[model samples]
Target: MDIESLAPVVDSILEAAETRGGGGDRLSVSPHSFPDAVEAAAADGRVPVIAEIKPTSPTTTGERTEDSVVLAEQMVEGGATALSVLTEPSHFGGSPEALDRVREAVEVPVLRKDFILREEQLDTVAADMVLLIARFLNDLDRMVDAARERGFQVLVETHTATEVEAAIEAGADIVGVNNRDLTKLEVDLETFEEVAPTVPEDVLLVAESGIGSQRDVERMQAAGADALLVGSAIMDGDVTANTRRLVTTEGHDT
Candidate 1:
């Protein structure tokens, strides 16, 4: 989807935020260090997979009807370093309630993945981390600061080298390079490889989208990704085994 295509989704989110009114009452859950989890997995010589709890998406086929909490436990059991819960309800069949349940069910840090347009949206976020897309927001720095002030770590997503640099300038400590282009909804493994070098070594880098196999995992890791955010592949079948395949990297060429 292109930037214009996202107008309706963004509008819906804003309307929801308005209707709910920012109560600033985030769910009561113990904070887990998102970056620490990724770093620890990488330090252990393992591919840190931030498995996602995606029920449905615009690009993926089929809908996941399983309980979000059950799916989260399976991923963790399969050795996922963390979890990403999609909270966008329109295009992606997700809700904040799902994120809350998953966070309570797993010890791993949970990232609230949504097209966050305003800082007020952060008030309702209960996860350990919040995703802020650089291409979507006009003032990225303000959103980053707002998330931090609310005690939430920020994952600034970028699609190109310029976006990566902009994310860094916006004071983003964690940068995620999304391989899928929003304009065409296309996935390219080389996108991460091309943009990974632009991310500073100090910032934690996460390769997002289009990663499904052990070879894909190796490719991203080799390109300097501290972690991989995997969705459709893991959600497709046998969540645990799928997660294990990416995490263990066994029987696959190094």
Candidate 2:
């Protein structure tokens, strides 16, 4: 990834921070419990799915026609354990307002899925969980601390084995192995399977991207993933049915 591709998102977040006086007091906090919600979703011994609310993507041209809030409600009704809302504006066609709308419409914990770089950005958004991409941060530990201070659980996203190690070194409680390589915009399921074992058992492992079917969900679970973060596929069709299919898919015998 050029890394610079995220400059617009960062600029917008920083601008919001400046406008808000660089404090979290102005942000509306979500009451839903993220970790607890994930736990309950996984209680059935099936991998819980975090259905995402994304209208568009830089990698693809087709955008979902449904309203984000309505889609969030449908996903929740379809048995989604948690929700992820895209907050990046330029490429993903997302905004903090979209996240806020979804958070208000659903009871599940909502994750602010954006190219988070600074503490100010974390403070500016209201969500139960925050995403910290390992490769994008100049100071991973500092940003992680910032997220924690705001009472948000961090989902440290990694694309490689080295990034996974860095996430673990930063004491990340949830490690998301992104199957899609951000730089190339390519989806490879094997990436998660190859790096999952390196994560400690105590830390939760999440497989993000390229999960298109029940077999795909099962494969990730078999590779030691505790959860799945599915977006594009769910947004492309009936949100409720898509989420139900992924969540209800049975994995191999443990």
Candidate 3:
């Protein structure tokens, strides 16, 4: 998505940051590691699924009103390796408190999923990992460094091959390819498949967005995705069952 389309959202986040005074004094260090969880799951011969706690999204049909902590616990029961909690309040219907609740309720590493524009925003993030969009930031490397300094692992997100290169050049240890083209709000599974080959083998690869079923999970695995970050699909109906289906889906060996 053009960063301009999210101007209002970014502005709101900045306003909130200013109110919070940009410090992590209230936050405690997370003992969990996001990439380690993914690697452990893959080593155990299961699909590494980073199930998301998304209440609503601009592209979804409706909102989920379930308790965020409850959803997070259920996802862990269903074999989710890690959890991605949306903290973008305006369009995504999420809040930082929800992320904190989920993090406390589950043992898995929690990823802060939001349109993070400024490094100051990272100061109060309690999540174990953070999502930084390669296409959104003018200096991905600086943001990555800032996140690392805060002791949070980074998942650099990209939508194309060029962005994938930018992520690597920015020193991203884990890279996620999002299938949805933010500008059009349209999704195509081929987006990840097309970009997967361009990612180096040593760097962890995560397939994000547009994954809704066992078949879709398999397709991503076959295309060399080390992990799958699923959102709306699992949040639509039964969180536990939906997460179970995707995590247990049979797929080619990575």
Residue 44's lDDT in candidate 1 = 78
How many pairs of residues collide in each model?
A: 0, 0, 0
**Model 1 vs truth, CA RMSD:** 2.9
State the lDDT of candidate 2 residue by residue for 144-206, as single tens digits: 877877778889999888998888888898999999876456789999999998999999889
Candidates 1 and 2 compared by TM-score, better number: 1
Off by over 4 Å in 2: 1-31, 250-254
Q: What lDDT is obtained when candidate 2 is compared to the true structure?
A: 0.81
lDDT for 33 in candidate 3 is 75
Cα TM-score per model: 0.90, 0.87, 0.89
Candidate 3: residue 213 lDDT (0-100): 80
Flag regions of model 3 displaced more than 4 Å: 1-28, 250-254
Candidate 3 accuracy as TM-score: 0.89
Clashing pairs in 2: none
By lDDT, the best candidate is: 1
In Å, residue 252's CA in model 2 sits off its true spot by 12
